[model samples]
Target chain A: MHADSTTTRKAAALAAFAGLDREPGVAKPDPILVVDNVVRRFGGLTAVDVAHLEIQRGSITALIGPNGAGKTTFFNQLTGFDSADEGSWAFNGKQLKGVPAHRVARTGMVRTFQLTKALSKLTVMENMRLGAQNQRGENFFRALVPGSWRQQEDEITERAEELLERFKLNTKRDDFAGSLSGGQRKLLEMARALMVGPELVMLDEPMAGVNPALTQSLLAHVKDLREEGMTVLFVEHDMDMVRDISDWVVVMAQGAVIAEGPPDTIMSDQRVVDAYLGAHHDAPMSAEEFEEQLQEAEAELEAEIEEKA
Target chain B: MDWNAILITTVKASIGLETVVYALAAIGVNIQFGYAGLLNFGQAAFLGVAAYGMAVTVATFHLPFWLGIAIGLAATVVLAFLLGIPTLRLRADYLAIVTIAAAEIVRLVFRSVKFSSVFGGSDGRQNFSGDFFAMNPYSPGTYGIGPISFNERVTWILTVGWVLIAICCGLVYLLMKSPWGRVLKAIREDEDAVRSLGKNVFSYKMQALVLGGLVGCLGGFLFALGQASVQPDLFSTEFTFYAYTIVILGGAARVFSPVVGAAIFWVLLVFVGNTLSEAVSAGMLPSLFTVNNIGAVRFMLVGLGLMLLLIFRPQGIFGDKREIALDAR
Candidate 1:
């Protein structure tokens, strides 16, 4: 029963990309975000320079790369947090170039910070309520008259409460977010983003500082997002998480997309391997074999030294 | 020591004009610094600009008193926008730096000889408050209980000032409890976090600046009317620092804290200055401690008291310790 249920869960997302080739910038069957000629430069260094990329709708896409791969910078450009030097991207058929960060989020694409911004001074519940868009009470004039926004506030509180319960943070609802543990903060941040009712959720290194015991639950939360039909794009360095949760993987190296494929295939892709471990690293060898190779090189060096003498 | 005279003056100072003006100014600081985490070091500039706006319009252009009032408010809002547009997008400290400089510039411009004919240079404008006093509903008689009392003109301004303070406190309370206030507090903690959640952080900061500036401008209007004159030096950087001191003393971000804090601050200064001068006159202290230097001594003693209060309760009189803990960022 467990195996059958797991397969059914995977079937929904995997089936969509079954016929697509494992190639860089291959067209998705139903792309939600399409980027073209995106470039960002700081001084003389180009931080992110992607020619083309497409995010499939309703799939968990893992953007995997080593440090300084410009994954976060690309995320920043896509979400309107940072402007690209030259690029235009469309989200759900709307041109998002030059759009402000808040409007981009209002357009159903919400992002979380890598550092986990939990609004430390606010209670967990207030932090959640802050994520609800188009709040009537948020308007300055309407805010003064409690009658105008009381009902909407109640509804927002109700929704926030439900999300808190689902995230198992109902008990900490009234507690300041600053009091939460690192793992709980990540959960709260994810739960708060859902209050926006976003179509696309971008998480930047959600597991970076999280503890191991909470990793399983965090993984479950990511899967639940897919189950609810929301597209998720996450940046991660943990190979286990990338392989376990991601349906599609995009590898970035030196400010460019080097490989794209399903997680299983991308793990063995030659270029992906080279990007991670360098081109010189071949198949793994036994310890004795490695030692033997080192000694052989040392013996050849000794012979050269003797001939020179 | 003239105990009765000292007691009367000290008690009067607790509810004096200075207290009301600083209370209102500190309330504005509470909104900007206490809630929004905006470092508005130029709060005195808001007061200065409003006073000058009204003074220039009425004294120079011979406009109606009401028009001068309107112009003052309009100028304050414009000043807020001007100061906010460039600095709100930068770090919080930039606003502090710009506001401090802008405040000095406003004072100097009012004090400048180039516009002496318009701004009255060092003399400032007078006779512009005739309409304000004429509108007083109270009859010409002393009104008060015991030592805390005022004549009809003083009573009228006091009534108006206290009513303004009550209204501002009500407005702040209502706004702070709403979703808009929640966003401001969230911005205070982490603006980038609020922005990522779909809030227009810049717009919110600007609105906060304007709202706080308007409230602070009320103090400026009161100062002008009470003195029946607008002086540039009265709205100097020292005025802004006093307002900040009152806000911190009263426990920032709390409604009514500024009012209470301002009362306490003036009371301490008046009480200390009166006692020290009285003592010096009576030859109770040494010859070096003269009445002339008692004003400076009062501040020195009060500064020590403030240092002690901060050490024991850094969060101020009513601030939450948990909030202070979260201020590590």
Candidate 2:
């Protein structure tokens, strides 16, 4: 009976994510967020100029690109950290144009920074408590009267403790976030974002400075987020991590989306290769081979110079 | 040379009216700069507006003393709102620039001959504190031990001021331990992080401004009542800087740091000034150090002390250094 029930649950989970693993920008049966003609400009540079994009519900989507490809910039605009010059987008079918960053989080779409802002002066537990929504203790007058929010404060503490344990950070809960290692701070940030109970969590370069030892655990956490019925949109440069966990991938280059597909197809996409490897796509196999070829050319040029002298 | 007299006076100055006044002001600065990480260089304006509010209302407009006090607090709140609306959204330095300029404007307006009819211009106003002194419950006598004694009036003001300080400290302690205070600290460290967690950063900053301004305004009431007068020059930009010094000296972000800092600051000022004056009179020091020069010398010594403290221990006496290592960006 137990085995039958497990198989049934697995079948249901597979059905839910079936069509979402298709080509990116292809309309999902139930998309949690949709973007159209969103553009952002900084001085003379157009940082993000995404024409159209859609994030599938309950699927892990990777936004992969080379550096300066405007991946982070596009995330900022979508999450309301920065405003778009024009165009609009919707999350859960609600328009998000001109919404403030805090309001966007309140509307069940929260984002984590690429640099991992961990409220350095605050304790990890305090940072987690700050993430919980609508605490009575946040009210000025109520804050003075502890009894007014004591019960709710207890609830938030319990929740924060649970999240800390889940992220294996309960040991460091009392320590100041500034004292944490880079990877630990990234974990704290992710755990803090989860405290909001967000439907859509946007991660900006989750593995930027993380060690290889922690990368597997972080990847597992991202996949677990999808299993827990939350949609994730992440910006990453590691193609291995993208292929390992991402259901769909969106490739950006020079402030625009160049290609979108499942990770396997995206790896072979010519535009993505050109954007990443450039015109030297047919370069030598290894560093030693390339160095040998450079030496041969240099020897020929030196011989010509010697003969002229 | 009455060295004993100088020692007694220095001891008295440690807990005197000036100490209480600056301590109260520094507590407000603690909220703005220490906790919220706001750079408010116009804290003296809050005190100034309140003092003038009471002075104009009671002495010039013939209003009741209580009504004057109420109007004074309301005016401080209004000033906080007015200042916060335009500058809170900008960078921290913009608030500092605007606040210093706004404070100067307030002082100039109070000093201007155009407002002499209401503000009394540079000469200032008096007789507004009579009602407050009339309400003093203490008997008419000197109160205290030895040379530290105070008259009934001074005793009454000291009692009320210290009580207010205690209450304000308790309020701050309770608030800082709450979730709201957590958000303020987070904002101080990284506002973008707090905002990303669904906090209204602007609203929190504005609330902090109003709360700190209101607390600072209480210092103005005490000043006006203690002296029975209000002058435009008394609320100069130097007053705010003095408050900042006290906040840092006591340790920023700690509740009782300002109170202790204010006491130490006044004691040091009085001690240095008295010692230098006595030395000058006794011809123990060079003739260049006249009694009149003691004031400047005392301030210079305190300034030097502050610089050294910042270099060696930027967190002050009781503060954790991390609290003041703000990420204003």
Candidate 3:
């Protein structure tokens, strides 16, 4: 029964993109974030130069690329962490091009870092409390008068407790964030991001250093975010995660989008294969195959030397 | 050797005016550097500006004493803003550099002959604290136990200084427990992490700077009132360094640690200096340590003691061991 229900939900999640063409920068039925002519240059090298792209609302979109593909840079620009040389993008139909990172987050879109930035000195609970928005006691004058914000403070703590429980970090609530293991910190960061009550959540490599044992739980959490009706945009190199949780996939190479489609189709796309594996190679070279080829080349050189002698 | 006098002097110096001044300054440093992780090497500038503000208002302009107090606090806030606006948004090192330079600049400006009429140049200003003494409610008598006592004027100033320190400590305790202070602490750890969570990191830093500067200004007010004079040379870089030393020695991030740190620091200096001078005069030490050079040698011994403290217990007297481990991250 669970399997059948999950398939139905997955189908419903992908129904929005059913009629869209499998092409780079295809228009979505409902775009929550729209980008146009976003370009970033570093000296003589053009880092990110995406012409146009749209993120479908309430769908899990995976941004995948090889090393130095500018996937992280593009995420920075969209989330206001880094400024683009020239670009225009809108979140929820509001112009967010020049907005600062904190203001952008205030507008219901929050991001996590590529290198997880868990505030080490803060306790897990304090880190969670810092994530909450519109805190009354966060104001300097209001903080001095506890009577004014006592109720709000209690409510925020209650919410933080709920998130901590959900993320399975309740046991480590009072421990410093720095004390958490790599996997636990990832879960805490995701749970903390949810404390903002964001509509669109952006995660940069949520599973970068996480162990495989914890990868299953992390994947479930990502899926749960979509179930709760929040859009998720993530930059990742893990294709298994993208295929399992992502509803749609956008592939970038050389700082530009190369392909866009459902996960299965995008995996089979020839352009993606060319981008990952060079055009001349029909299939990816495995380590064993590479080793065999190296041995063969060395043997051939020895035979040539023997013939010459 | 007059051992009784030396012991009494040590006890007195522990809670003396110098202790109150450094304690207040260190409390301010605790807020900015300890809690917020701001590198404000120019904290002396905040105190300098406050002293000069009051001196210029009351002695030079003939304003009311209360107005001078208000102006002193206002000048501290303005100085915090001026330093914070350009550097708080940058990395932590920038504030350290700017603050150290700004403090020297403030001292130089006050020492300049061009503003001698207004700021009194090297002599600074005097007779500005007459109104402050006139308001004291203490009668003309010594007040204390045994040998450690104060006159009416000193008793009043000490009472005010201790009260101000209590209020500042209370304020720090309340703020650090709130979400506002949590944001500052988080910013101290990683500003980008706090920024990503929707906090205006720059504003919080600026507020921490201003709050700390105001606390530092209280120290300046007490110093000026206690001496009835403000000297430009007294508010030098070493004054700020002494405050930093006290903060680190007491324990960073704890509300009352600076107070404890200040008392210990003063007692050590006074005790060591007195002992050294007495030994030199009594012929208890070698001729290499004459009375004239004992002052300098006393400092060297104290420096060695501080170095030992840092090596053995870097977290200070009251700091959490867990915090020191987290700082390694």
Docking category for candidate 1? medium
**What is model 2's DockQ versus the real complex?**
0.55
**Per-residue alpha-carbon lDDT of candidate 1 for residues A3-68, written as tens digits (9 for 90 to 100):** 565567678789987978877888998999999999999999999999999999999999988889
Backbone clash pairs for candidate 2 read none
lDDT of each model, Cα atoms only? 0.92, 0.89, 0.92
Native contacts recovered, each model: 0.89, 0.86, 0.89
Best by the DockQ measure: 1
Interface RMSD of each: 0.8, 1.6, 0.7
**Per-model DockQ against the true two-chain complex:** 0.73, 0.55, 0.71
User: Model 3 TM-score?
Assistant: 0.94
Q: What's the TM-score of candidate 1 when only chain A is evaluated? A: 0.89
Which DockQ-derived CAPRI band holds candidate 2? medium
lDDT of 3 by residue, B153-242 (tens): 999999999999999999999999888899999999899888888999999999999999999999999999999999999999999999
Chain A: TM-score in each model: 0.89, 0.85, 0.89
* Docking quality category of candidate 3 according to DockQ thresholds: medium
